[model samples]
Target: MIPTLILLGLVFGRWWRSSLMAAAVGWPVVLVATDVMSIEVGLLGASALATMNAAVGVVVHQMILRMTRQLRPAGSSRSGA
Candidate 1:
């Protein structure tokens, strides 16, 4: 799901927006799941996980995008070579 969300971000050329969207969607789901399942969870722990998830998704997506750009043919439109 993280990868998919990142890909969606790439497709839309707005990785930051997608990263924030994932966090927005994920935090609430985690909160609800924890509550409905009667699981003992701490706010700090859940928040940490959500933050890590968002950071990883954005970082990885950017890295992949960078690699793709570097690997493209130099004469490609974006490369302007």
Candidate 2:
């Protein structure tokens, strides 16, 4: 789930190649930090959770982008204040 959130943030928030590179870099860090190789595999439900997490990430990022654009000060002006 967390990974997919990162993936969507990378995809929707950044460029495509950056997204891919982030996944490539992040996965290994997670793998090494967690060290799950010694455990047996049984986390099959992760795919479903990942999907939801990604959706949430995309939505939140899109909203933030939209809000930032809307909040930007209109036109250029001198800062004589």
TM-score on alpha carbons, each prediction: 0.52, 0.42
Q: What tens-digit string does per-residue lDDT give for candidate 2 at 1-81?
A: 386665566456634344444444554455556875332333223333444555555656667778877887776455845
lDDT of each: 0.60, 0.53
Highest-TM-score candidate? 1
Screening candidate 2 with a backbone cut-off below 3 angstroms (N, C-alpha, C), the clashing residue pairs are none
Model 2 alpha-carbon drift over 4 Å, by segment: 1-45, 76-81
In model 1, which runs have C-alpha deviations exceeding 4 angstroms? 1-13, 21-26, 37-41, 78-81
- Tell me which residue pairs clash in candidate 1: none
